[model samples]
Target: MKKILPLLLIVLFSCSVHSQLNRTFMGKDIQYIEKNLKMKANKVQNLDNGLSRVIFIKEKDLGSSTIAKGEGTLDPMTTPPVSKKEYYTFILDNEGKVIRTDYQKEYEKK
Candidate 1:
């Protein structure tokens, strides 16, 4: 009974330490991304090939003409240019530094 009690306590202690380590690692990753990438990203999704995906949202006005209350007939502009770009995914390392970046790029085969 004495030996069993000690083994149980050891297991519990190890589990607690593991959980703490995990939290620290996550915090470090968050800090790295915020500092290096200058982005407020959270909740990383790990993908195959050792890549992580991060999501962020940004707001922007339509345009000066559209925002103006009194204008010479606000003509609907075709696809207003993106004032702010939203980073959908960002590949990061253990330190959370961006190792690679991927934007909109469709593959075409001729």
Candidate 2:
């Protein structure tokens, strides 16, 4: 039982992490990107080398953005005067298979 418990825990954790990606456009084809990551995509670009990027306003929004756009929002008055958007990048192969996912570095808020 002890050995089985540890193995089961590892399987569940891995599934959780992978589910997070599966819930989004990650590991999916580029054709579905717009439908998947639109509203929060202040910007999106597809590169020649099978790389696509979607940009969002805040770190917290970045999470929601991946799941679906408009899931997160910012208040104009509370928002900082100078702020930058977070970038979510997807790497795909020639056949349009998602290779990996990465995010831009988050800078400290002043």
Candidate 3:
């Protein structure tokens, strides 16, 4: 039972951590998302015809992946490449309800 207890706790913790962003946000109101997910959008763009887009940016370091081409030795002086940023965008209708969602990840320049 001891082994199972630790495994179960780990599973539950991971589930809550990973639930921050998901497809279930579709059709949910903006307030519900902010309160539940504890996330504030980085930017919001208002579109024509009473539509708006909410964007949340999350940046994470992916660590070094550079391969030495000269002597197969990593250079200590060189800096690692910038990691990709996650963009979570939600399109809301005039009534402030989520209508669609989009997610993308790409490396951004400093």
Candidate 4:
């Protein structure tokens, strides 16, 4: 039973570590989006389809102003609709720079 005890402990420890890793990854993504994208993001959630998702609402205009129009219309006048053509699921490293991006397709019903 001595060997079994150690093995069980290792399994439990690994499971806890993996859960913590996921939380940290999600938090890093939130921070990166807030600082770099200048957007306020809703809480991250894992979808039933197994994708981690976050909704970022654009908050500031970086350089989208026009001389005549003042701040350009790039800012959504209202809450922007989620784009089916453009959406990103970002994979961030420990440093929080996007390591890769997975674009999601619009769901279709048969």
Candidate 5:
């Protein structure tokens, strides 16, 4: 069982590392959010009223899946290079406290 213990620990650690951000930051200020996020946001926008929007994006390469030019030129079926994007949006109040959070995941063809 010695080998199994090490494998189990690795699995648990990896799972925690890749887990999504949680909403435990509700009502917390922007600085707190930034600290926990551990990454800078891709975009930030000021919205109507006293609310502001903060967006964090992460992109993952899905490898090249494109077909050869001449090989698939005549064929109508062809796969394009694609990437996966994850978006996390946070809405903060005038006081810079987080009011709401959103998450979006999508695949884009390049």
Candidate 6:
């Protein structure tokens, strides 16, 4: 029981840390984004317009399994999962300061 208690405490503490780190807001500084998300970005580029754009692409949300069919809800026991493509772009000025941020969703290709 003592060992189990320590393990649970460790998990809770780690969860707290992870949640804090995952907190994000718009208009954050370019440096902050670069420092935190460079490794995760699909592409980081300095444009000819003397600005930088860092793009992060993810399909992090999966649709629910329950679906409405013929006025009744049906839950598939084993079926394909659905996901949406998401794009996060951070636009930075010449001084490496963020000018704006854009989040876009595109239809997934079949």
- Candidate 3 regions exceeding 4 Å error are 1-22, 65-79, 108-110
For candidate 2, write residues 73-103 as lDDT tens digits. Answer: 5532233333355555666666776676655
How far does residue 34 in candidate 3 sit from its true spot (Å)?
Answer: 2.2
Q: After superposition, which runs of candidate 6 have C-alpha atoms over 4 Å from their true positions?
A: 1-28, 34-39, 61-64, 68-80, 107-110
Per-residue C-alpha lDDT of model 4 across residues 47-108, encoded as one tens digit per residue = 44345556543222233323444565664443333323323355544444444444333522
The reply for model 2, stretches above 4 Å from the true place, is 1-19, 39-80, 105-110
Give one digit per residue, the lDDT tens place, for model 3 in 46-107.
99899999988888776656454677565534446677887778899999988877766688
The per-residue C-alpha lDDT of model 5 at residue 96 equals: 92
Please give the CA lDDT of all the candidate structures: 0.52, 0.57, 0.76, 0.48, 0.77, 0.66
Query: Weakest 10 consecutive residues, lDDT, candidate 3?
Result: 14-23
Best by lDDT: 5
User: At residue 104, what lDDT does model 1 achieve?
Assistant: 30
TM-score of each: 0.36, 0.40, 0.60, 0.27, 0.60, 0.51
Query: Which regions in candidate 5 have their CA more than 4 angstroms from the true location?
Result: 1-22, 64-81
Q: Per-residue error at 104 for model 2, in Å?
A: 2.3
* Clashes in predicted model 4: 0
lDDT for model 5 comes to 0.77
lDDT digits (tens) for residues 50-90 of candidate 6: 98888878775564465435554454453345567767777
Higher-ranked by lDDT: 1 or 5: 5
Rate residue 30 of model 1 by lDDT: 51
lDDT of 6 at 56: 76
* Global Cα lDDT for candidate 2: 0.57
Go through the candidates in order and give the clash count of each: 0, 0, 0, 0, 0, 0
